[model samples]
Target: MQSLSGKTAVISGGAEGIGLALAKGLGALGMNIVLGDIEAKALARAQEIMTDLNIPHLAVEMDVSIRDDWQHTARAAQERFGDIHMLVNNAGVGGGMGALGNLDESGWRWAIDVNLMGVVYGADTFVPLMKGHGEDAWLINVASMAGMAGVPLAGSYTATKAAVVALTEAWSTELADSAIHVSVLAPAFVKTRIHQSHRNRQARYAPTTAPGPEVMKMAKGSAQAVENGIDPELLAKRVLEALDAKETYIFTHPKYRFVTDERSANIAKAFDSAAESPLVADVAEAPMALGFVDS
Candidate 1:
């Protein structure tokens, strides 16, 4: 999808951070924008930014995790711009910054709903529209390096992000024959307000359990990491380059690529052990049975 001029993009979490950076970058290329965010104040600020820049846009205050919200947002976007060409499922939260069992049920549920279900809802809502359009379309799901290299004390965040990465990979294959192209953005860290996400967390999802020292420490460290992270505009530029190349797995910070590589190596070693076992061939199903090609 080389040409973005005059195209329309729907970005969840478009009010700030990486999402807003992408909005600015894409709008610069003459694309119409639909900015959906849960924060009303931030959405208003984003709208002002769009108006100031003379970009074609509609800012919709909507929660990406809600299924009906997507329908409403779609209607608004289509009414304003018509035929969405890009969907960036970027709305997410930093949560469960502790060992898996330490956080209460609310923490887990909140993370699953926002971090994982948000992307699910976005894809379910937009993929059909994108397929109907013959022109080029792009689906960008923002994962994280934490998904690749699971960080301690962030069990929920890592799990949800890893799920997003897997979902993007599956959707990419499913949409391969269609006009919709998919890319999963996995960046190490970025200067964003994500660490302070609790400020916007809904009341229904408030925690019942008090976090332990480890959880508090994790939260503090995460805030520091975010403060020293790279500018989101740089990540946005990288995304554009990746989209131009139609790359499925968009990444940044090559110096940290070794982390994912190391994970891959560990996985391969385990697979090798299993494949070498004589019991493997006895129980293994044919590639066709697993919907896998025998290359």
Candidate 2:
């Protein structure tokens, strides 16, 4: 997308926060905005904003966690806008908020379904559609800084985000031959409703037990952090600017680079020790002797 005008950009969770900001920004750029969200009221509000700005748009009430919902969104987008040039898998929920997860099976399932599998389903449904159009396309998956480095008391979130980063990186490489460019947005924190994500959690994903004091405290702290975080508008702006770079990894906050740098340094140090190990050399020589590996 060097020229986003007249193209279609479908964003999940586009009802509020960063998603909504992205919708507004892209809409302002003269692109057709398709807002996919689970909240009807938020969707209505978003549509109002789009209409007020005179931006061509469509609001679809759909849960990104459901595979069929993604298909529905795609069908609706195709019918309304024809070709989809951008897909932003931005729907996610904060879950298992405790060290090692103080959550039940339901909590775990909710996190994985909405955060991880949602992105997977979006890619599965939209890649072919974009490919068929024979035009350049973009896939931006929203992960967290926790994806770069584990955060204490946020095991489930960190795990899913890390998986998202891995998936996006691999897809970027695999899609290198195609015009579909993949990028993962890994931001530290933003002024979003993610801290209050429980409000929208489905009944099926309800926890068996109420949150303990520690979890409650963590939630309070998270709310504060979110309130103090960067504005979603700035994040949305960064995203649009980053799309031009066509980089595999994008970020809204560069102050958190140290976190990723420290993690990478530690992993490199550990790998160095492993490579020097006698057992590692023995396995390497065996592979070479068998001609299974290049010299």
Cα lDDT of model 2 by residue, 6-54, tens digit:
9999999999998999998899899999999999999999999999999
TM-score per candidate: 0.95, 0.94
Model 1, span 83-112: residue lDDT tens = 999999999998656676666778778889
- The superposed Cα distance between candidate 1 and the true structure at residue 118, in angstroms, equals 0.9
Q: Name model 1 segments beyond 4 Å from true.
A: 287-295
Most accurate candidate by lDDT: 1
Model 1 poorest 10 in a row by lDDT: 286-295
Please estimate how well model 1 matches the true structure, expressed as its whole-model Cα lDDT: 0.89
Clashing pairs in 1: none
